[model samples]
Target chain A: MSEMTGWLLVWPILLPVLASALAVVAWGRERTQTLIGFAGLLAQFVAALALFVQVWAQGPLAMSMGGWAAPFGIALAADTLGAGLTLIATLVALAIAVYAWADSTPEQRSGGLFPLVLALMTGVAGAFLTSDIFNLYVWFEVTLISSFGLIVLGGRREQIDGAVKYAVLNLLATTLLLIAIGLLYGLTGTLNMADLAAKVAQLPPGAALESIALLFLVSLGMKAALFPLYFWLPAAYHTPLPAVSALFAALLTKVGVYALIRVFTTVFPEGFALTREAMAWAAAATMLLGALGALAEVDLRRLVSYTVVSGVGVMVAGLAIGSEAALLAAIFYIVHSIIISAALFMAAGLVVRSAGSADIEQLSGLYKGVPWLAVAFLLAGLSLAGVPPLAGFWPKVYLVQAGLDAGAHMLVVAVLLSGFLLLLTVGRSFALVFWREAESAATPASPAPGASAALAGGGRHLRYALGALVLLTLLLGLYAAPVVEVALRAASELRAPGPYFDAVLGTAELRP
Target chain B: MEPLIAIVVGALFAISVFLLLSGSLIRLVMGLFVLSNATHLLIFVAGRLTRENPPLIAEGMKVAEAGIANPLPQALILTAIVISFSLFAFVLVLTYRAHRSLHTVDTEAMRVAEPAPRAARLRGRDV
Candidate 1:
């Protein structure tokens, strides 16, 4: 790729960072902030798409900032996977922008919604694009601060309660991540990921390296909300506004997962059997526990929150299995989860607006009132549970095949059981929230104020956003071939790590 | 000198963990700051302390002369310090605001979300 093509990598991150400042300046003018925010996201979406195409056509693209070479300057590199994720995240952010505009009360719009959202996109894109470990740490902090502002934007007592836990836990998580980056730099005397990969390959697998990998796992795993480390997620995710929660649900943990995959596969590809085994067990536990938790929930938003945890388990499981097929499936599954979960939350938000409560015990007969929304909910729910011919099903198929091929029979069983439990969870929620009549439930949660008014009010944009996501899921289901191919190519590049290193450094640095 | 620094980092880490484990939210927040500093020092020692000249090279030179201090890790440490400082500040305010609103800083008392499990909470008291 030419230097011009490398600008594609910079624009997705730069535009959002600039737009965030612009949005802040236009903060009091809600109308201008909204327009500027939308324009920024739209431009980012276009740039991200261009990046995906450029990487697809030309292998990988890299730009070392300030005209310095790798191992010195920060390397911003994008392969098919990074660019693909950026594109998907941008599309989701745009959808959320539309929904947030409609769903955020006038008060929230004045409170810097547009700027916070744009800053969040900036962090996420930067995280995916950067090859410098320390720079990745910076991007994570950027993501963290913006998300903290967003989670508590409405300043409901519950929002603060949730934000406090979210902020404290994630702050600790990122701090550990920074410490890991620092230690990794100490060991290799380099912060560039490609350089570290080469240097670490020379060190014999020993206790020191093992300890570093453990630190990386705990930190990133906490961020990704794996199994025992995940209570913070269900606690905080339900407290935010639906649009804010949708953004968090879509991007946050996945970034952690991305970092996990990047560090593990790129830098430490030797003798990782023990950690991979641990991840397998964690994945199984996370899947089973999260699905069961979802099944046990009366509150609809918390129910969806648990599903996000379970979905993360499946992706981690795919990574643990570590076959090309499994990696491909994992990448494919991430895109599926981001879209479906965002759609599910938006659908649940609509239910909350109409029924005046998120408690399924209080919510009933949504299908009778809003059939379109009911369909949207059912479609999202089915896709989430990995029903055949949906966006979720193909990844599951590939994962099962890979698990069998790898002789991880137990993990295969775990995957199947997790999906079965998720089906039950989704089916029960659908019955309780949409089928049952309101008077029939034994108890109903007190309606949040203005719930009915919110439903009756002008929320056409909210509906449009939800519909666009639902349609995207269906399209993904019906046309899985292209996505699967892209995922496979991305995973292949990730495993090889040759083109990636060359892109960051120069082709002359390739060893073989 | 390195061993002394390591021992101090370890002691600080122990103290921070003890503080974080306390019931008081104020202590927990303070522990965060303590842990941040301890980790910074850990990184500092890991980079290998030396009383050598600062890592600087003349403009035309390709590399710094021998005995120059390692610059990369210092740069890493600086970035980590700035990031953690801002995070600590945000966290201090967040916990305080949460305490003000919820009337408690105790994590055990902060139960606005995810209360006791349904079975445990119900305890056969179904109405």
Candidate 2:
């Protein structure tokens, strides 16, 4: 209990913030920005791995910044779950930086893309690490602004339209979140999450805390793109460059899920009695609608965007289960979905680049040219559909088992139905793009719409980055023992908040 | 004071929601602006507005007076206001740019991204 590992918690947030500042100083220099962003993520990834290992061994690490005591100063804390997410986030971010650098389209390079991405990384890292609800809101704004900047990098009519919707919805969400935080502060007289938890559990169950919880749910639901509010996701996600889309698909909604899990598990663990039931229903609708949306889309990016929403629904259902086993499954699913979705988006980008269009009607046999890419794409599709022996399958298996254990019969059905629906949707896209041949093969200089795809120039690096991540998905599936163990431990820690409280408050208060 | 502020906050939120539901992009922007201001007011009121006795501790005092106002909420509101200001600025520029490029300030005409129902049906055979 020497409180030595606090530096690990700070490194993830500090490096990115500092790098963002440096990137600003070196602004408009694409070369310098790319280097700074990549190096920052590289450092973050390495630091995250070290932090994860440390947290797994030590339980949780926290520090009151500026040497201020608990309930007085800002606290940044990292448990197994937070560190693991930071690690995965940085890994994905590193891949995206490399892909965007490789893309080198003038739009990709301009509008301070690297700096904005670094700022986004800073926000995401801060969101995961901060132990104060108000601090979490601050990080949410940082993440939102940087994302808006990245979204409008191209300023195309479509991108601006997408950004408008994205900004309006997300800004509204953050505004509501701030209100929720203010109310929570008003109720408990403390903003530190641990202090609030201790204070909340002391208050008798009442409407005040319940209303704040609901506000948080609505706020986070918008961010997570829960049912009836997910139109903006599909509208905007596909308009950005593939690398940017991949980053958003990988991390943005997941942050929403992260906030939900963090708040429900930490502050309102036993507080929000009825919210879980509403969330369970919302989760089911989200899954069904998201899958059906995917099923009906001919545009590849749009299909994948719907899949992103579907994955959020699955994670949300696990959260609603609120059991340690269910949480473990949710964590595993988040990891799996992040990798698969990023890989799928990158694959679709290559397809769009090589084919000159992502319209399914325009696409034909891709197996003939880039056979390796076709194989990679097929693996991603199967993995997303939760095929056995893939990363997506195990998470669902755990989710189904846990749902049954919890007697959440609807959740179980929704989970299974979503898996099956995705299988049909992704399988059809795979077949249409890779299997069918052009009937009139003798006509044009460009390969037949049904012909195998050729890898467009400058896609070599993109494929390398994508291949690395997809290989990770395979590795996750084939050898999931360590990850599962870690996830289970994280869930168990969440089940008991004593350690989280102690970690943030340190040993000073442990004297009985 | 709290009740009056609550009513005002409610009114601001109501108008913003009404504006938000309109099809005009300008209205949408106004909706967000009004919505953010209402939220700030809500936070201000929720923090329990006390008249003018700030929670500053003198240099010699070990502890501050108990009845002094809670400065934390004010700090929180300040941070929120700054953040929302930046976000609103971005949204304003975005709306103006969107209008310039898409040639419409109407959300209904913002279908540059959405698929047309007719197109979806005609090509719907494969999906």
Interface RMSD of each: 2.9, 1.8
| Clashing pairs in model 1, backbone N/Cα/C closer than 3 A | none
Instruction: Kindly report the interface RMSD of candidate 1, rounded to 1 decimal.
Output: 2.9
Tens-place lDDT per residue, model 2, A15-56, is 888888898888778788778888888887888888888888
Per-residue lDDT, model 1, residue A194, is 91
Superposed Cα deviation of residue A329, candidate 1 (Å) = 0.6
Quote the TM-score that chain A achieves in each candidate.
0.96, 0.96
lDDT of 1 by residue, A360-407 (tens): 755766666677788899999999999978899999999999999999
Worst 10 residues of 1 chain A by lDDT: A443-452
DockQ of each: 0.57, 0.71
Worst 10 residues of 1 chain B by lDDT: B118-127
Model 1 segments beyond 4 Å from truth? A440-453, A507-512, B58-66, B118-127
Task: Provide the overall lDDT of each model, using Cα atoms, as 2-decimal numbers.
Answer: 0.86, 0.85
